[model samples]
Target: MASQDVVYTSTENHAGFKIDVVQYQPTKRPIEDRFSVSTKSSNRLLLGVYDGHGGSHTAEHISNILPTALLSHPPEKHAQIFRETDHTMIRAFTRDHSLLRPKSKSSDWVHHAQVVRAGCTALILDIDVNTLIASYANAGDCRAVFYPPVDAEGHLRQTEDLNAKTPSEQQRLAQEHPGEDLVVVSGRLFGRLMSTRGFGDACYKLPHGTIGNWQHRRYIDALSAVKESGKIPMNSQYHAMFHTYRTPPYLTAAPEIGTMQLQKDSFVIMATDGLWDCVSSNDAVQIVRGGLEQEVDNLAEHLLHSVRATRAPGDDVTILLLHIIHT
Candidate 1:
């Protein structure tokens, strides 16, 4: 459940910039209208993919809140703002819930808590100076992708020195690490009924210790009770979101932040459940690099178009694109 922080090394020269933002929310049935935008700025650009859960309010809140945070803060505090946005959104959801729910004596706003509990997965990719920073804050299982310098042939390829798990790679994730089980375990071991980490769903997770710890502690002996105790039991039902919760927390906001530089050709993408449900990072990268030459701006928009055109429309598809300009 370690979630936050970033710093990137600058390349020798900086040159290109492109940003793409898109979202798909199934308001009705036949058509899925998601939010999307493409922008080309003088030097800096912001591309974000916020895949929201529970309600349109939460999805929409990310659309509203992220811009405000970016607009309000200077470059230095952007990471801090990302962390703060979770609390801010939860508060906003709580407030908005009041509008939908009329106060009742017995109701006590308990039923309406789900609205506040609704959390969004946020992936913010920022290109500032010569550095590229990737920040991922998720309540559930939204994903982000970093495509390193492509080959001379201009394919969206990467030699993974260090990067976040690709969508396909993450599918293979067997289990959580010790101390990282905040979101995996549900209900009381002895009376602790809740998740260990996350944002929004405050009803289950705590300001701290919501995700269960999964890291392997140094076991004292071959058959020590304490070390064996830390292992999550197989066949033991647990809540990932409130989807598995007994009473259900239904909210979360645990963020994992990572960074790299434009030493080579680099493109970073952030997306919500819409694309992640089907598309893999490598799959998306091929589309991004193949859509258009990296030399031009608007790669982000092109990427959105590519994903939208190809992906099966079972859910909303949201994507944000940031292309490194190596001058």
Candidate 2:
């Protein structure tokens, strides 16, 4: 049975800094998106959002374990830090994918488990009060937008574009990979999935080995048979795109990382593609900045309500409104 929608809201405060969060599931699909806020110290904070594509397991697992995985490593340079963090996330995802492998399941069932082709995009932000530096890393389309303090007219100021690349940019990146075929099906990686890089999706990330040769042939044959029989409907043709044990390592978990100096009254917005799919970054910034000014404790809830009311039903929507209070 399809489950009902779920929405959650909460506030996390540390050393007078507050992180307002809202999580919403607009459709009946499982809430595959997960988020968490943690503090390394009174002056340092970490926030993350994981958007699962095939199922919630990968996202749930990342939500529960990624924070600790990150905290275990001490601070370092921006590039080194993001690289280390990405490796940690990849390891955690690989471990869980192996565990979730069903002993007797069919290829179709395994495909749905997110192990064969399921995965989640990751967006993480690290904030330091002392330096007012906000470092971010992005693996998929999940995005972060910054809204500076209001101007004389009370209009929110744009700090810079922290959002991820557009779909076209992602395709360009896919083509950059060696031996990736530069093939894009429906604007997704490998011509099948929306996210170009992320955790899990072993069939895409791992290279096909000796045993994978036969598996690859079987995979293509099965898909061909299914297509020829007209079993998959046109509207759902995307589902026919699954991963094969191809070599040369087509997909990756690497992230794009950068640092920005946060203005005194700056606030950062983080969310999954579900929310972005419906609401533009500019619209989200306006709503959230206004809410922050109004001291809206339910800002996350209000954002979800606006998204659900304004746009068509979307994927799981998760938003985090983080206000940095400089001491």
Candidate 3:
């Protein structure tokens, strides 16, 4: 059975704004998503959502580090910040000798390897209260949608979902790895990861032979242990990926950045793919519009309820709604 949902609202930032956040985990596996909201100054508000796969380590780490990193840098440097953070995590994982030791016990090595392999999609929104500018940086499939003034008929803006499934993303991958038709198979990178850009996932980004050598040594050690104990051998999921791996750095952490000027009757919705899997961008705006028309108590919770009533999310769901009240 699914665990209890996490729901809350915050109005602690600058005046004329209310933020509602909700998270729902529908599986037994650890919730692999993380989110944050912080006030950088009287003028700036930062919000982030990370959707993790393979494990939650990368998402958790990014959640803790990214907000401060973004607050310290200018908008132009945000993309570089993301790449640097990802590289930092990769370096830390690769240099940890305690995890890479061939003679180490299986559980220890496996846990470390899993941490290295984990990756997460990121969506960050930086709102400037003074300028009314909302800047967003995104990698992977996490999304943000802007709802225009109620009088403006049928106008909505949203971020693109950057995954191997998108044609433009596929073309970019094809260009990067020429003649490799298998670079994307069935909407997944190397027929495995769906996200084409994000943090961590060292197995996809590391130098080609790095993971291969580690896997070979680890497999040998596992075989030896199995022979001695007559136990089933531990298998690494990336073995097949290593066979087809050719290029280094197949995935990236560089985010696509965008900006919008907020106005009265406007709001923004930021969510992980779990919500998008069941609700389209247009539908999401409509749901929020209906909620506002009815003067719902909590917009985010109301939206989440609508989603659950329509179709249950297969993965962890996180939603953030920012209600813009012009002063």
Candidate 4:
């Protein structure tokens, strides 16, 4: 068994505001989750959490590039940025057909396939420090919750979860596919992926022969190599999914964006599903609230410890906490 690894970081105190981040990796496999924090200037701060499935490649790539991409574009263009980034990833994979040549090793093909088959959920928060306004964009199940509850005109602000299990998401898939009965089964997209929106996972996003004929053929060949190598089970449901893949772009990376004004002592927690799987939203808020009341040194780390006490995490857990305070 591999030992658990934890990463913790805290930013310098700025006008009594601070951010804390922590990640716990317990699995033997390389952690597929990635996160980033960019204090671009005194007035701007960017934070993101990416949860990758199938492999870590997509998450790592997004973590490295998304912060910069978001910073380059205006806040209104963030959704377009997410979609363009997904397209860029697919284009990069299609341009490298040499990896699919017969002479290439199966392992080589598998590595290249990661660029297309792996996908990641992204949740980004762009903050205007001086104004204490935060704009959030979410693409998957990763969640951002505000302590003391960010209420708008007497109602709590809510963000929908973009996954097959969500009723509206299921309805959207059915409506998009029309008569496709298997668009969702057992609360999964084609009974394979839980996320209905994210970056990468080109195999799910690209339609048959959408890429040039030659490139699509090479893509199929690479997938066959990956299967033959037994990296994935031969009888996996994905086999059926590929054969039945009719409508292209069964998933999307377009983020749902919203903004809120911050208040002193208000806390925002952004985390991957790994933490949410074991911790309830209300419980998480209480934990953070308690930490703040007690003036803990690192609230993110404290919340992580609280989660581990109940049960060992089955996946990589990441937590980012932003605390607003007065000097």
lDDT of each: 0.43, 0.62, 0.78, 0.78
Task: For model 4, state the Cα shift of residue 29 in Å.
Answer: 1.1
Clashes of 2: 2
* Predictions: Cα RMSD each: 13.5, 6.7, 4.9, 4.0
Candidate 1: Cα lDDT at 78? 57
Please identify which of the two predictions, 2 or 3, would achieve the higher TM-score against the true structure: 3
Clashes of each: 37, 2, 0, 0
* Best-fitting candidate, scored by TM-score: 4
TM-score of each: 0.52, 0.73, 0.85, 0.86
Rank candidates, lDDT, best first.
4, 3, 2, 1
Output the TM-score of candidate 3.
Answer: 0.85
Candidate 2, pairs of clashing residues: 114-118, 185-191
Which regions of candidate 2 fall more than 4 Å away from where they truly are?
1-6, 74-117, 149-182, 210-212, 215-246
Ranking by TM-score: 4, 3, 2, 1
Judge candidate 4 against the unseen true structure and give its global Cα lDDT, from 0 to 1: 0.78
Off by over 4 Å in 1: 1-16, 25-44, 70-80, 88-117, 130-140, 149-199, 202-252, 263-265, 293-311
Worst 10 residues of 1 by lDDT: 1-10
**Model 3, 296: alpha-carbon shift in Å?**
1.6
Model 3 / residue 263 / CA error / Å: 1.2
The candidate, 1 or 3, that scores higher on TM-score is 3
